[model samples]
Target: MQAEDSTTLEATLADGRRMTLSLPATDAPWAADGLRALRPVPPTHTGRGEEPPTLPEQPALPLEVAILGFGL
Candidate 1:
């Protein structure tokens, strides 16, 4: 197993929000094998006769990753 390391990353989102993240420092390509898909949630607080309108399916946005200053 690789030794755990910490690194800080800062970025400005498209909506002008600044965000920071702390992640493990490594030179290897990241993997998604440990990730699991999320389940859908049922609607809440519906009226006796009101029905929620069906939403159009939207394409998933590509993930963005930053790997600044990897390794100690």
Candidate 2:
């Protein structure tokens, strides 16, 4: 599936059918929401007996130094 242009979008179904749509500016938000709804949800993790992975600890930064660095 791919967006053809600013006003056009297209997709190829698993059964080999090609689908296309001509979108008007007013319906852009609806089109966006429709696309989002079509996305597949990821499977949840079910660790039977395995231990959860641990991330390495990161060094903490000084609060004043971090604040001063933000704008730069």
Q: Model 1: which ten-residue window has the lowest total lDDT?
A: 31-40
Pairs in steric clash, model 2: none
Q: Write the per-residue lDDT of candidate 2 for residues 1-72, one digit (tens) a residue.
A: 676455666777767998887655555555665433444345486458777899999999889889988875
Q: Model 1 compared with the native: what TM-score?
A: 0.26
Off by over 4 Å in 2: 27-72
List residue ranges in candidate 1 displaced over 4 A.
Answer: 1-6, 24-72
Model 1 Cα shift for residue 68 (angstroms): 58
Residue 51 lDDT in candidate 2: 78
Name the candidate that leads on TM-score. Answer: 2
Worst 10 residues of 2 by lDDT: 34-43
Reference-based lDDT, each prediction: 0.45, 0.65
